[model samples]
Target: MATIALPRPVPRYRSSSPIPTLTHSINLDGINTSAACPIPIPNKHLPVCPPGPAPSDKPDTPPASPPTKHLKLQPQSLLYPPTNYKKVTHNSSAVYLIDAAGVAAAVNHISQQPLPEAGQVFPWLHGLHPANHVQQAFFVARRKALRKTPECYRGVTIVKADGNLSCSRLKSAVTTDEFMQTAMAEFKDIDPREGFSVRNFQIQSAKTAMLSDIIVYGEDADEVLRVGSDIAKAQRSRRQGLKALGHEVPVYHTFVCTSHFEEFEEHHPEIVVLDTRGELTGNVLDFFHQERVEMATMTKASEIARNVWLGPTDDLSMSGPSPDDEPFDLFIECSDLGRANVPALKNIVRELDSGAETSQYVEFPSSGSIMPPSWPLTEADDIVESCKWIYNLANGIRPSEDEGEITDIEGDSPMSSPIETRTSRPRKILIYCTDGYTESSMLALAYYMYAHGVTVSEAWLQMHIDKRRNFFAYPSDVALLNSIAPSILSNSPALAHTAPQDVTQRIHDEPAWLALMDGSLPSRILDYMYLGNLGHANNPDLLRAMGIGQLLSVGETAAWTAADIAAWGDENVCVVQGVQDNGVDPLTNEFDRCLAFISMSPYPPSTPSTKLTPPPFRPRPPQWHINPSPLPRRRLAQRHNLHRRSNARAVPLLPTRILLRARAPPQRHHPAASALQLRAAEVGGDDAGEARGAGEEGVGMGRDCERDCGDE
Candidate 1:
């Protein structure tokens, strides 16, 4: 890849263009002042600092004080040299001069250094060095000029070893020779026998061994070791008292034996063996000799020997009769055989080994006898019991009489014979409509019913205006009713009123019947219908049939007026009505049994009006009227007195006095009777005084008047 050069910034000077100097030889103190001369210094002449302590203790001198401040001035640009002023050089002693104008033109120059050879060590190819040779060369040159050591190296080759290669015996079929050759080439300097191996190779010092020192040029080394080990072991075995014929060998270990007959014939053409049966004695020899053996009489003696060594056959059928048909051969039985026969047994182990068959055998301790038996059937019974237990656990009870019944046990249910039984309650539905009034509120009401476990049909609305043209009335207009009523009726037939031909027809319709059905009505509007008759009002056989007892409409001119609702006998009913005015319609029949008398609200419809009249005020009696007749004057006067006493402190003095004179005082105030006496005296002469003095004044006066009249 081509290299990119970064531009250098030029330092400005006041005098005839200052010369460009190496960064280390800039003499910052000299050029920092306005009067300094402009002179270029070659890179080689740059002051170099050696590793040493400074010459100190000559004298203690303070730094010169800064000059007084002057007027601020704009900076001037230095004249930089042209781009072609200097040529690139690879020599360490090469020096280049630059003028002040050329200082700004100084950029990274491409190095002409030759590329490092493969596997060669280069100083630049150290830790985290650049991959490009040009970058490393530039870095080296700059470091040498500045008398600084490069922190990284680059452009070095790495050689990787194959010690870490993983080979699978099952998949890799390379011959031993091929595997060993590959391993030897990878670790040419280190002998495999010495166990010298490389792990996690890294270029610690590129100055000595560059990346080129690391190379992975060969195949897997593990395969080489495995093949070499097998071959060497075989050769050693043959040299150590093991007979070898050509590539084949007869080898025997304590527990196993092998003979490569073909290989022996190929390697040893003169070897001959008249009887391979001589290798074993007694029963072992008999075991091999009883086999159906084949022979090539015309073959070489070496071939015959090789065949006998590597391919000798044995008949295991004659070695012992079937254990099931006869007593096992005691001489060859593993349990009866003595320890001294272990070595001989090992040599003929393959002949005595059992064929593939599975059996469960038990041995008799006293007689050392063995017997095989079939698996038991109790496992199936245990599984059946487990299934029953699980069934009982899940159902909380076991089957009894084939039916479910509550048992005396704390949590168990006794089963009873299957019979028809009802497990759910009948659902009750309420259908309601308003002039498409407060749809959100109505939907919320439906949601509340659902939440409370009440089944409610969708509300049917009767609107009086087109909704599309009047967005404001869209929530409460008749057009919305037209659009949504069909869907509501289709979904909830029990709550729907069939089409009516006339007002009378609708009055007799099922919807009207549903409206009168037994349900909790909003208390504010319940006083117009009888609770007992609500459900059966439209039923022909019911007492209130023909819908006479039902409230047909909820208009302002409905059968029950707001005054009637307000005056209802039930306090719960009236209070609930008052609360419903604020949009709270609680579902409690405790309010009123008269379903039609409830008044949800008396507010006028929300249609836009050109002229709106203020609602008139409603007056309420100061006291409750238990009877139609007015209260007695004396009782009125007493109540008036009580009311006045309640506000005595609030009334003006003059008004209070007039009110006190207008009404008789209460009997409870007899002890403070001065004002009563004064009023009585004004009404009648000394009688008032006599009345005040004598408690029975009226009785004596009546007798005196009667006696005087008798004298006359």
Candidate 2:
């Protein structure tokens, strides 16, 4: 009933010549430029200069020396100011929170300057004039003054997505392991490792979002313009939307820099400038140790500072006539502002600063912790002194036996005239930086810890998740925060009378498992189990710090020496030798051993289903056995048909006969054609048989048909 046609021969080229010749070749080296352009244009003749009066009639004069260019420093008053200020937070308090842009805007508005279009001289915000070198220098210097490092990482960086596995490996792991499904669901919301949480934990809010009393901020320097543009666009869209709804945009009073503290106080006495400037002046000339004369002559930023505050030229000096006396009103009340006490945080910054020249590890006996070299480390006493000063300012505490008055050599109030002088804490305060995050972040973190009774971890999460501010911190900064956290908590008036709670005791009593959640150890696989590379396994101290009791090495063993083992006393270490990370190696045989080692750990898995318990022994299933002798070819089809009839799902036993027929060229009368018909009938029953019968009647079958089947 069926026919098979022979396949056509594949075409092969035969050489007409004895030897093969190259085809489609071009002579690249023999390009004829002259032929392409037959005639080149002739060069134009040079005109001779007209004869001038004889040299003897004119007097020879030496060329006048070029006049030297003198740098003209732009006055602070002349610098471009913003027309309107954007409030960073929606806290309807006395103090207004604004960024550098808002500050410049406020200063311009308070000074009663008209908008640039209305005849104002400068059309740009201070330190934002792209064409002005002086403003740029001052802008760069002011931002740099507050930071120990040049760049920082912030906002949804390096976060893990999906379940706790790489996207590529997740498919297979989930497919093979039933326990993984349960584990994945359990730890979905929970952060497996700490430092930063999952991207879901990052908060996104409107421009008017409440950013508490403090905020940590940092980002790569290169991203400043892009990020600023994005923020501006978002704000503009929001403003437009609000206006369409006929709602009025709120405006708050703001001060430009600490330099105008007196004028600012006069207009808004309730707001305070929590100065967090670092030790560096951020002056470009300072790096080369330029003298005062050179700076005064060549540096526009320095000249601007001198113009604003006549008394001082140095930016780092704490002993100024007033806070505003320093260049650009830059002052360092605290050297390292906004440091935290989290180890995971410290580890992150330290790694980031690995190649930095200034970063160095320093141990502080006061905090009983080592400050990572990623940031500059300051003495504990200096931090304490700064804290005390802030405490006095906030609480309206005057000069007492313990603290000195903030005075100048003249014994007069430098902040204001004696008649206008008053002693009370500012009701509102703003902590900000030129760039979005870095300069202001640390100071804000410090303020939060000192004012609130929370530890570094709590403050970090609170600001990021609750307040909705993204910030970055260096390890040294965190270490300093750790050192000073105790004093801050104890000195905090809010917590003085309150009973000890979880927050107050968290610094000392945090659980060991917290390391995994916070990113102190390597990657966390489960609550009890962790995953790490060979490098991490070699560090016994790191494991001990995280309270990791056992080490299970796969693929590669740790490079641990005798001392490493001693340090990790009673080490429960196991290695799966000869297993390489290359995809070829099968981990099937090592599964039981690995599971046994993991289960033997003192720490139990978080869920019962993921416990990796051995299954109860049972006898082999009878269906697994195979028949030794095959049935004769003649009986095969009958047996297969009977089997299929008995159970419609049963497999047809025509594979061997089909393979033999496949090796031979197909013919119209081949007996193997019946085997295919039988297979089709088994699969689809009478309908398939009818279809096959129609196919046999309609088409010819041959080697070409077999080739098409093979291709499919």
Candidate 3:
């Protein structure tokens, strides 16, 4: 259970007597804190921070929201480098160390370790930092990132033991989730909604060294060290017994933030007390943005704020700034004040993001569609290191000093000179489609088509059970995937042998209810603008569906005029010269009159107006611009070649967003031409008066689409 279960009602205290009576309470155990000092103590004799406030202690005053300023956002191009962040201010460097040998009993026994001379140190990997706030921040981010991939099993902590046959015995494969509820039952309780999936896990056996007992519920790192020391002692004692029997210890320390926050309220930043720390802080600072994000979200985490013990000296320390402080700024006095607000101040350094300023970085989309921001990376190399870090610790194996060191890096940004980069495998088990309405269904069809050796019809039939929506794909996407299907299927012997010829023929011969076909198909159009190559100028179905009984095809031979005949014509496919890129942009020159006619009144069969009396002009939904270049499939193909055994074949649709013309604001055509201009600059594009052109009716006012283009 999560520790946050809302507060017991705020107490109403009377001041009748000289002394006030106490009512409100928490359950923090009292600790002896006489050893704290302003001077830096050696890592070997570190001060102990408590876990949280006591039951009877008063709750800290809640802080107010921060002041916000409106900022404009510019369009960002895809397939480019990640947004470059301004350099972050470095204040205090905090460190967390896990005693592998577990020898530390008191702060006096805990010797601080220096940074490795080589390779990278992923801070989120070990969860062994001295700074309580910093470590917790990384932990929170890790939880967020992991939740994005519930289906992926790479990091799941599995305690696999069924009454074991080893030196140490077991009962079952208890997940970290189960273990936490059972083991830490007394310390913290989590609500299911606030709870996170289990990333770190352990196996339980009768002989498994119990480190849980050593962890004092309210005591901090010193207690952790004492627990580690006891575990080390147990491992040493069982060395011969385990070595002769050929078994490694199953008990190991995996992190769980069971402790509450208020334990370390007075914590503050001091100097880097350890010598020759090397690039210790360097690896951490490399992923500096992640740290900034975690800290930023802390401001909104009122539940954690009111209950959890945090250092008083650092940003994580609970804050009660004066009202004069920026409205939402919690720790106003921290040196890295601006840095802590990095999440909120994204527009300060304009970068390409989905929802830069408007979003608060938390969303649980349906069917788990959204991906987590990177931190606890799933890259093959990172996973290898993470597995090594967690498992080897359990097995009493220590990595050599030079083991996981990182070799490549530059300042701030990690990219380097034009080295050929290998693209990663597909993102997950489902194909991604841009149109949200049909993405889930499309993914289902795609999975069956590619993996099951089924014909398009069969695949559609398999997927049309509950989610039976028309799945649309660009003609090119289908062709590309179809071209590669044979090769992939041939390699899968079982699939190849089971694939039937007549059954496959029936699919094409019979036309599936959910077939994957060209966009020209009548069933494919989600709306008028998205008519991929599904229809031509004379297709009645297309004209009828769009309610535009007429199509004023530009650059084709037909009449061109803005009369009622043109504006309200049914079954009318008229051609006009100078329509740009197949009538995509009606706002451009020449076709303005025809576009105006269409905008003025409803098309045929729906209040079919015989005369063109212009009503209010309403532009279509905001134009969704997509990068047609390098195509999604092509990009994925280049990233990695598909093979028989590769399961990471599911590719997400390339992202698309509103570009040149956004939806018209109320009583206004668009935000301002400036918005479009800024978008153009980001993409190195030219709108040719596009932003102002569509919304402005001055040119096409009262013009008739009555005449033919050839005649004109």
Candidate 4:
């Protein structure tokens, strides 16, 4: 892909320059007008330029008047419509005295009335004419009086059902620290005559002052501690207040609800007051005295004091002590208070007196769960670290700094280069067994090889005799051999089995084994084993004809040695014991031996000689006969003598003593033959005669020989 880059054009701005002025006008009369003329011209037809310099530098300067001409000016109608204006009315009261107008002296009259007192009302009369100004004044005064009335408030608890402190109260309470302090002072005031007095109450005074129970609750109970965190800051001032008064008071803050209170009261009723309201109403002084009461109980403090402390506050002094100080026994959080409360909580702890110990309570609103709501709403990765920190803290475990790094199974860097690359060759193993080989043993052997990364390719069970001529007869022997053989053969290499009738019998007796031996194992089983049975052969009669010794010899010579084949069913059990110790598959080994025998057999070389020989010719026997006529004894004797003579002639002559003396055989035993004969003889005699005859013909025999050989 080709990328095109274009540069953005820069913006240009026009230079600030004054425009040239032009003279313009409209002709109103049939007269030539010059630029200097004082006569007014119509704007539309005014000339823009005269192609010469102006008479005056200023364009607005008036020129001399033109000469008068004897012409009468015609009157023209106004160019625009005239607007009519309406007069506004300003009414004033009129006074009248009827004297002169009635032929008696008549006079207009006016009267003045004295101003009324601040709280007084006007009378009906004291005047000659009624005055509008006094009446208007009275109306204004009445409206002002109404405006001065004070507003009245309807009393109702400002707390919301959802546990949200009224916003109005929160604003007021949070802003007015002086007002709250004054309220607290008033709470502390002891008026004997008014039946209000201070009473000291100790909580678990007999026991060491450790936290017994902490309960927190409120509308914004969760936020209570958070916003009130400043209260911890106020701790030092509070302690100062106590010290100034020569008194010691412990204060614990928490945000717990009724359920938590009940639970705490049940567990530590001695310290946690069950009926908070009862305690509050019974003794106001005692209530304030035990400032360190569990937060749940303290929530029921007198309205004045509760409002002062729990309400919103803007005072910097209210901030809490530092975080390094002991954590509060009970930390109360106001549920309604969001992130803003965190600072408050921190401030409260920071403000605590240097050595003062207190319980902390985190209060959530009635709807809020005790758990911190998931926070830092942003991308998942942004808050992941925070979540991890929170998880560690919640689980009471300290997370290590290196926790985020990735590691391998051995806890080492996985990126390091491997020491060596493994070879791709498949692992192979061969198993040998006999009738004595059990299914369990094969399975075990398979498992062992598999664990070592060696896949067993071939398994063989042999029923052939050992040197002792024992036979394998076990039924399971065939079953086990058949079961594992196919898989081993397919995955690794070829598996072979050799046995005479007994082994064959064991196989034939079991359908599965028979199927395997016949190479007819089902496709489903083949798929399961992941091997196909390619071929099979059996010769029962051959086995019967051949003795066990001869078969063993054949098997051994053919590569199926005793050590390789497993044997069973022997009374002495020598072969079986040997197989057990050696863990060899005798059957497969024997088959391998048979395969080797077939592979390495001398048959091809000996085949033509054995098969092509002609059968021996047999002579017909002479037929016997009897003479029918008895006459002529002398003629019969002569016929007999002729027969005897013919028989003698028929007999062949035999050679007498033959002379036999010979030197070494001639180098050219056949001088008539040529180089071709020598070459033909070297190869074999089958072609020597034809080659010699071709050479004798004297035509190029080489080409003929080559052609003949090619044809052959």
The best candidate in terms of TM-score? 2
Q: List, residue by residue over 491-568, the lDDT tens digit for candidate 2.
A: 654466655563357578543322322111132222344333332354444444333556555554456666766554
Cα error, candidate 1, residue 47 (Å): 99
lDDT of 3 at 579: 33
TM-score of every prediction relative to native: 0.11, 0.22, 0.19, 0.11
lDDT of 1 by residue, 1-712 (tens): 0111222336755778776655544567788798776776568997676677755864435676665322222211111112343422221111122322222121111112233322122232332233444434443553453111221212111111223212211111112222223433221111122221121023232222211111111133333233333333332433353233333322211100012223223332222121122232121122123221111110001110000000101122213323333111111111111112222322221122223122111110110111112212342222222222222221222334342233432445444345343221111111111100111122222222222111221121100010100000111222222223333233222222324233223223433323332211111001121111111112212111211111211101112344433432122121112112111122244325323233222222222111121211212223221111111122121111211111010001110000011011111000010110000000000111111111110111121111000000
Better of 1 and 4 by TM-score: 4
Compare candidates 1 and 2 on lDDT and give the better one.
2
**CA lDDT, candidate 3, residue 565:** 38
Better of 3 and 4 by lDDT: 3
Q: Give the distance in Å from residue 19's predicted Cα in candidate 1 to where it truly belongs.
A: 99
lDDT of 4 by residue, 504-604 (tens): 34333442323323111101000001001111102111111111111111111112224323231111011111111111112333345333322221111
User: Candidate 4 regions off by >4 Å?
Assistant: 1-477, 480-484, 493-712
By TM-score, highest first, what's the ranking?
2, 3, 4, 1
Query: Is 1 or 3 the stronger prediction by TM-score?
Result: 3
Return whichever of 2 and 3 wins on TM-score. 2
Off by over 4 Å in 1: 1-439, 445-482, 488-712
